[model samples]
Target: MPASPHPDPFTGWLRDHAAPLTHLDPEAPLDDLEPLRDLIGDARVVAIGEHSHFIDEFIRLRRRLLRFLVERCGLTVLAFEYGFSEGFPLDAWAQGQGTDDDLEGHLGETVPVGVDDPLRWIRRHNAAATRPVRFAGIDIPAAGGSLLPALTPVADYLRDIDPETLPAIEQAMRIAASFAGTSAASAAPAWARLPAADQDALTAALTRLLIRFRAVEPLYVSRGDRRDYDLALRRLEGACQADYGFRAMAGLFAGNGLTADTSARDVYMAESVLWHLERSGPGSRIVLAAHNAHIQKAPIRPARTQVPGPDRIRLQSTFLHTPGLDAFDGILHTPAATVARDLEEGKTP
Candidate 1:
């Protein structure tokens, strides 16, 4: 018999369960987004992912979802895939301390920014908020454009808290100056050309700085505010991750593939989210915005690993892996974008 035209049970089930999005305006009333509440029950984070970045529709939908989660679910922070060390100034701008251009400039300084709408929306909301939605960056500094985003803050902190330790951070800075470039893709190749001695030295310098931060935590805390000290230490941690990530990426050029068992950015980003959540105190929920691939639970296989690496490395997915879903608690799937972007068709953005 000829097959019926009806879709299979799986397709029908998805259609039945899916919540229809009524509007993409962030300022829209929250009633339509109520269907998501049941899915988000008791979840501490509601991570919304887009199929592509910088798309107008996805950006607006993301903004809408963010508003819903904040107003309806009481989520208080935006843990974005920006640089963890660079979040402070951006956060300050989100609280209305700077002009729009100042906020835009700060956004560019921290990472490769595409839009400022999200921060603008958050700022407007914060204007009269008692518990304002906070901004949090959970990625490596400058998106691996340069190591200074991570290092410069640490240097300043050390200068204030322990001037004697400036040499350690300064050495790391000098080494980074040689190889760090405009982005991870650029930095990795530059790092590969550096002597292995320089590679190892940067790592060692970061380690030494970390050790100093811990060994004198009490003294540092007394010298500076505990909050400031903690942030500085975290910035130091960001530097360590950035250095390791650059080397691991360089492995691909060395015929070693990326030696890191996992994407270093995702590892640090996940930790940064947890770190902020913990510090935000209990009962605080966060709205995490990032690419679809960065939020999945499935393991990501290493790509084209070279000598001294497994053919199929089974590690968690990252921004470096294939796009995956991040709608654990809730999802906002926009229609296929009408406009074409340069990054499409296998072009790396």
Candidate 2:
């Protein structure tokens, strides 16, 4: 009705490109979402990004968009910003393996928000379907919670196929225990406090595991399924990444560094999404549900944020900006955009 209602030029562009979501209900007919079909033309991953998490409107919009993508666009995999290693059970839940009660417990502790409904719906949708829908967690184990989620799995794999390597994994686990007692982001500081030798030892242990895994891929594959070996390798990679990222942030905390590291978590996430693509085979589509900062190619300015340790940080979603590789071809936004009434009033909530 009103031309470019917001004074910002970007809002005008957004209004021009975005088709306002009609209803928040996933069960509702998706005729209103038809406009997105062209906007999302031939994209492999349709990343639905929210400016903030735990917002009711954005969360509902994600649900509706996910349903539409899976049902209409033939996107079989719904990758999330949750823990990669801890996501196995959640993925199983999507495949109808667990009851709602079981899923409730997992999602409560595992994913922060917005993933439960999609997983529940996937479970129902896969009930009678032959191919069935899929779920993938692209984040480090437990969403930056702990290294154990990934490390423990790697250790288990080594225990089964290459027992000689157990000591290395065990060593890494021993150092991880100082901070990774639980799946919480609080471990970075504790990890920072670990002796420099212990920290370097953890890296060394993981390096040994990686070299061992690569050295005997065929042997390990023969002992275990190829898929299992590959997944284990990738999961170990996640643990290594967690160590790298946490250590960098810890250094920033301990040293007051100005910039973020190589953006290890986001790089892992981009690779994880690609791994899903390879597994799904060519021409398959995936729907990635994550924060706007992680999905948007343009950087998000940290405005009025109390986040410490850096004047600026390396952005997410940029790794997905690989040349000729389009991570998210389309993005759909909802109506609600503001944070809170208090935030608008310049008062911290």
Which candidate number would show the highest TM-score if scored against the true structure?
1
Candidate 2 lDDT by residue in tens digits, 1-349: 7766547654455567656666877688988989888977888888887656656677777888888887888888989988777778788888878676788787654434567778888888899876788898888876666788888878888888999888888989988877773443467767777888999999999888888888889999999999999999999988888888876787575676546473778889989999888997666888998765566664434333222211222222232222111223455545465343433444321
* lDDT of candidates 1 onward, in order: 0.74, 0.74
lDDT of 1 by residue, 1-349 (tens): 8877974654565576677877777777878888888888878987876655656677777778888888778899998878888787889999989687787567553323333677888898999998988899888876776788888978887887889988888998998898776577677788777898988888898998888789988988899898999888888888888877776666655677654533777888889999999998768899888776568655554433221211221132323442122223334566665432424533343
Model 2 bad stretches (over 4 Å): 1-18, 181-184, 254-262, 299-349
TM-score of 2: 0.81
Instruction: List the candidates' TM-scores in order.
Output: 0.83, 0.81
Instruction: Give the range of the ten consecutive residues with the poorest summed lDDT in model 2.
Output: 317-326
Instruction: For model 1, give the 10-residue run with minimal summed lDDT.
Output: 305-314
State the local distance difference test value for candidate 2. Answer: 0.74
